[model samples]
Target: MPNSAAAMSKTGMVTKIHTRIRADPFSAHYELVGKELGRGKFAVVKKCIEKATGKQYAAKFQRKRRKGADCRMDILNEIAVLELAKANPYVVALHEVYETSTEIILVLECAAGGEIFDQCVADNDEAFTEKDVMRLARQILSGVAFLHRNNVVHLDLKPQNILLTSARPLGDIRIVDFGLSRRMDSITEVREILGTPEYVAPEILNYEPISTATDMWSIGVLTYVMLTGESPFLGDDKQVTFLNISQVNVDYSPDTFDGISSLAVDFIKSLLVKNPRKRATAEECLSHPWLNPHPHPHPHRHARSASSLDEPETSQSESEPDSPVPSPDLDDLIGSYLTCPGQGELKAGRDAFSFGEPPFPARPEIQQEVIC
Candidate 1:
């Protein structure tokens, strides 16, 4: 018998032996092609090819140290979160990990279609119809639901973070970038001011404990932008934008949403609620009328604004009679929420009800890179 079996017999208890071997060094299996795909503050994603299988992948090279100190914990935390969500269809898959003397490399799936916003811009005239938006929205919700189910909150859920698998009709999507993701239990509350400015939830601005609702709020903003081609709370600058978000000021003028549907407006309102507890859950969002559209036999579909139909505007005095004074420190973090222009669009088919396979070319076997 093996030594482990012999020891188990001697002790009258089964002793498990760990026979797992470490994977070969990443450089041994893949070669960097010198083509840079994306760049960030501390990392650069480059195109790489596998030596043995000839498969393509995006290699994210992150520095092991920052300012002469170890910074691997951030990468490790991201890895842990990705491992828990590896099986999710909407999340980008992590294939391999490599560590070097001064950097860490992550081999990830390649999303050639690029950001959903790019598609929207490419097909400006025929922007994603309501049905197309529904399908994409459902996919995003599925990914978010998976993250929430695993006790992880994806603090950032914007158009920039959502990627398309191909440039074809109704292309599959993958949620990327989990640098701000946090793991939480049932009773634990996370209180960090993170996430992009226009998309950040009100709770984060108010300094309230954050939960899954934070992501839901972003989803609402994303949905609005996709439909109207404009941000609901985006201001001319950072301070105005932050003030708009904190005050929950939204514009639903007929001019802004001339061709939009009422059900779609309702869906956005459900998510953009100032109170986190009132925000819709991912599961609930999946069942929303906008996502799961029901045919209305009526001949005319009226476009309604949020102020006129759903949430009537209230004066600032009436809204915050007893609210505490704002803090300067929180205001500093709020600056990050400034509007990011030129975030491309999501492309979808005209017929929203048809769930046919997209006519996209087969994707290369390369890992996709997520921008942090």
Candidate 2:
């Protein structure tokens, strides 16, 4: 059966491939609505509405090339990681995919709330309340736990990649972006030295073996960023940033991190251990005192309301509430990033249809997993 946007919440917590969907690629059954969310070097994400169900989604479109490039492979790898992560609630959900002559489209669930980075960058002294941080941290750990169990390592874990569906009464938090993800089954260690320099683990730059622990280091960075509104490591150049990480020369002044709880700081210290072997696992992170939700109440704040962030210019009625719904235009989603294809040798007849069923091969163990 085709899953509607209304059914997303239930699906978000379980893994089940939509086998009923087949080759109706590029059909216009759905209506594109709302504003474009964001764009990358090779793809664009637009907030959209499914005409059939009146549901909102973020549609990512990657132009198809006769021959694939590193950018295209990165997108494919992201799809693979999302497939492995589907059983977790803390991970974004993949809805549908379509193909046009020029692009491959992926429909995704849009977290109604914006990026966590938006919150972090709002003010220098701004940071999530301890309760809010713990809620988000727990969600993040759940997603990471699911990824590690599937033998997939998310190389890039940061505030920008962490998204929220609802942040009021403190809303649902989820992790996004899998461009740097890799599977452990094929290669035991990663030496590629990829990922944002500031949040990368020390061993990554030293060309040492990369393990699940590497991601834990990034989680530590995330924890710090959530509490302090600043990244732990920063340098004018990549080389300098890497050098600082190797020496473990991070400076954490009490004045610089005012209002941050000691328990939170201690939790970060345990995970940010210079040695990978000493870093906490995702499961261990859940057990940290900082993440204990029982002692803390969910946050209540005076900041701007979520609906006020960027409400559609035109309002829709409640009876036909979706009547005046806005469309997330393709142009808005892509923004100025859409460029002419780069010159490269073209592979003839490389059939885009050959990708098989949408999402390709599904993991057998997905059925038993629970979204964090």
Candidate 3:
């Protein structure tokens, strides 16, 4: 797979990335330093240390061919997105890429902070306060603002995809997992029906055009979940979740928003709008009164701490999280659709639907979920 450039089928679109897939065994350069991080249908993320610098990184192995389809171009689309994020301060850095005959492994800077999902699920009193969430929201908005400024939308922005620089003292957030990211432009529209169901926007379900505003919707969900340790749109199953999102069904009851500030609710309201155009921009979110009430975190204040990196982590980047579906088929359909799917995301937004047989086709029961 030495820089194959098979043109996209109908659009004749060529990837912007010069993905020089190195034909080297990943171990020849990097040493596996920790336990395997996570696994999915076609990908697995593991903690590895660069032999040259002893710097720890997450090595993600993805199949070159998923099912019967050649996915080299789709992967290139993801690489192009990462290249854009590489220039941003709050994103994980993609350091190296190695390819075996069957699999390609992307080496990325390791974020030891684990996932924000961990904090959201924590029952401890100190896990988060309104102020803590505001700070985290600001950080997320900042990174998202940068990406949006560059005309990219991170289609997946759940808590599981956001990582902390450190777990203790609840460090500054670093946006990871760009696998589902897409570049937006005034001339062309990107549409796809693949995302973790809970955070997906209405436009995606409708197969409508995607924009930076799409990322804003997920931010709204993330903020809501962070403020109250509950999912706003999740239901008994995927269909229920999709229906809730399609109809803009969200819980704002006194019980759900107990002790939460009205400004915070307003902030979520501004973002969770059914129409993408009505949703607030990342920059607007940063200026919202909810986040402004507290002095937003200064960039230098949240530097990565060595103590945090030394701690063992249980975070898994590739596994489907928060899907209430009992069928493993749906789980794979949700998470494995993207590469790595780490907090440092690597999802594809190409016309991969044209590929021969989906990499991991859902059982007939869940196939409708994919087309939705």
Residue-pair clashes per prediction, in order, are 17, 10, 11
lDDT score, candidate 3 = 0.64
Give candidate 3's TM-score: 0.78
Work out the TM-score per prediction: 0.73, 0.70, 0.78
Please rank every candidate by lDDT, starting with the best.
3, 1, 2
Global lDDT scores for all candidate models? 0.60, 0.56, 0.64
- Across 75-141, the per-residue lDDT of candidate 2 in tens digits comes to 4445556766677666777777675656657777766555576565444434477666776777678
Candidate 3: residue 155 lDDT (0-100): 76
Candidate 2, residue 252: lDDT: 73
What 10-residue stretch in candidate 3 is worst by lDDT?
Answer: 346-355
Deviation from native of the Cα of residue 300 in model 2, angstroms:
30
Give model 2's TM-score versus the native structure.
0.70
- Candidate number with greatest TM-score: 3
lDDT winner among the candidates?
Answer: 3
